[model samples]
Target: MPDLAISATGLTKTFGGVPAVRGIDLAVPAGSIYGILGPNGAGKTTTLRMLLGIIDPDGGERRILGSADPLAVAPLVGYLPEERGLYPGMTGREAIAFMGALRGLSLAEGRRRAVALLADHGLPADRPIRTLSKGMAQLVQLLGTMVHEPRLIVLDEPFSGLDAINQQRLEGLIRAQAAGGATILFSTHVIAHAERLCERIAIIAGGEVRFEGEIATARARLPSRVRLSTKVADGAWHAALPADAVLRDGVWQFQLPQGGIEPLLAALIDAKAGIETLAIEPPSLHEAFVAIVGAEPDPVAEALS
Candidate 1:
């Protein structure tokens, strides 16, 4: 096992006596990328905020970088909240320096680092943040988050307003940071962004952690999808498909049938129709997300049936 970067046990919170986050437990290893995924109002942001010490957890304890008391370890961490805030009156350089200073750096050192950050992140140095595009503004914030050279960085919705090109750039930067030994914790509704970067993730819903584990482990829990294509159409062959098979564009796609693939493969071969191609689409992060969150329906109406 890798060195632990963050650990929280029985972390709970509430708003107006209503439970906002249940007894959630999470662990992130050093030098790895971790993602928190959930729908809107699922308390992901709230959990991250509490972890960053911007807000206190109503119950339980959170340890950062091995220190169970996070407040004493603030200098080793960097955080970017979901709500982006910058001094509109200040130029990009000054705004970034201000953020760096808040994280414990001299004004001169902060300004110098800010200038270098512009070069590193490919941002215009002299432009005021208010005059920049949202994508540009997001880049500036990302730079600010890393300006102080912290070993642990947390970002909330880092790709909210980025274009395709910018998103790719940010993704590359994240990979580079982890390779250099920084533990990254970020939250996003966009699952594809974490496809190649995240090693582990926590899926949250209704203020509770529904899932927490490595990306591969989460995927293993969901069966692989089977897709088939045939060179010849045979109505009788269609009848041989599993009852739950989904017919799409003359192709049959289905979850791993209850009997598994061997029986299905044998039946297809016995059908006597020429086979063109057979493919198994791996379960994507997006599909897993939908399966977990979308499973909760209105039971009041569903039970009436």
Candidate 2:
């Protein structure tokens, strides 16, 4: 069995009599990339805050890094908040070193690490935060968060402002971190990032978790897809196709029924249908997410742009 980096039971929070998070349980395994997925106003940030001990939970309990008190294990955790906060006058290196100091590093060691980290990412250590572009500053802040080399990294909406190029870089960084044995927990409404990066995921909607487990399990909630294009315009095999199948551009596309595609193929072969092409595609994470959480605005597309 794998160790849990974060464990929460019936965690709940409220503000002004309106529930922000309601009885959400999370178990993030050690040394894996985990994602909390939800749309805007889905209590993602609130839950993170509670787990980090930045805010008190109205009910339930949480244990982070095996400690009931998150503050006690603060040095083992690195956090990049949804809201960007960096001193305008501080140089990139200075900002990073300062964060490291807060995480228990000596000032001199922090500065040394900051210089190395900034240079590694192609940023000038001496450059002031205000002088850097928004994207550059974001990267600098991220480097600051990791300067102390915490065992677990938690990022809330880290992809919010990044363009495609930077997003890819961040993904690579995340993989690199996990490869180095750090557990990563991030919250995002952008489905594509979670699909690509997370091994385990929790889907939150309207302040509640609709599903939680392996990404493959979430995807398995939906059926596979089949696309068939035939030479024959009409045949008995048509009866074997799903009733919901749609024909578009001379191709028939539909969800495959459970059990297997063998039954469909056998039927087509028996009917003597002239088969031009047949394809079977696995269900996508987005499709499964939709199946679990219902239709949501195209936030992934919106986030990419």
Candidate 3:
């Protein structure tokens, strides 16, 4: 069996009287990038917090690197928070070094790594956090989170403030980290970004996970609609269509409810219809989100944004 980096079953969280996270289950594999996504307030951040031991789960269970005591296992995880902050008076190197120390690296080693990272990421060693651009500060924080070389990374909205160039760079860095044997969990609203970067994604809506699985698998769960253009007149193809098929503009289109399409093909062949072209357009994530989340962004996730 494959070793999982993080696993949670029936995870739950509450704020005041409200249940922020419902009994959600997560299974993130080692050396893979796991993306936690949702409309606003679907509880992505809270879930991360619980996994990091920053906030305890109200119920259920969680494990990291096979340990349930996340605090004890934290040394193996790197973290980038959604709410980013930096010491205004500290130089870029100093800020990075401080975070490394917090993650259990020695001061001297942290300094060495911080200096190398500053140069590698194109930030000046002497640049004060007070003078750096928002982007620069964000990058510095990222270096701090990663400098310790943990086995798992929980990044909350790592793409929030990144420009196009930085976004691409960050994506590459994330993939590299996973390649190096860390499980990366990042939260983002950019569906295309998540689609491009994550091997699998979980969409949480209404404080619960509405969907989870590979992108292709999720797409398969929904019915597939096909459009075909043929020689028949607009209304003439209806009689020959398979059950539940609809005709529009000399084209027959409908979702294959289940099972095989052999019957439909046989019907078309028996009608003596010469097929021109047929195409299946899969539903996109956004369409699936609307279908699963009730046509609106989760209120909390929106507020977090």
TM per candidate: 0.90, 0.96, 0.82
Better of 1 and 3 by TM-score: 1
* Candidate 3 lDDT for residue 23: 94
**Can you tell me which runs of candidate 2 are displaced by over 4 Å?**
297-305
TM-score of 3: 0.82
- State in Å the error of residue 275, model 2: 2.7
lDDT of 3 by residue, 1-305 (tens): 26888888999987888999999988888888888877666789999999889999989999999999999988778899999999999998889889999989988899999999889878988878989988888889998999999999899989887777787778888888888877899987666667778878888876788888787777666777778776655444456455767768767788764665666566556665667887878877656666777666444433333
* Candidate 3 segments exceeding 4 Å error: 225-279, 297-305
Between which residue pairs do clashes occur in model 1? Answer: none
Best TM-score goes to which candidate? 2
- State how far residue 277 of model 1 sits from its true place (Å): 1.3
Model 2 C-alpha lDDT per residue in residues 152-201, reported as the tens digit of each score: 99999998888888888889889999999999999998888999999899
Tell me the alpha-carbon RMSD of every candidate. Answer: 5.1, 1.5, 3.9
- Model 3 error, position 219 (Å): 1.4
Sliding window of 10 residues with minimal summed lDDT for model 2: 296-305
| Cα lDDT, all candidates | 0.81, 0.91, 0.81
Worst 10 residues of 3 by lDDT: 296-305
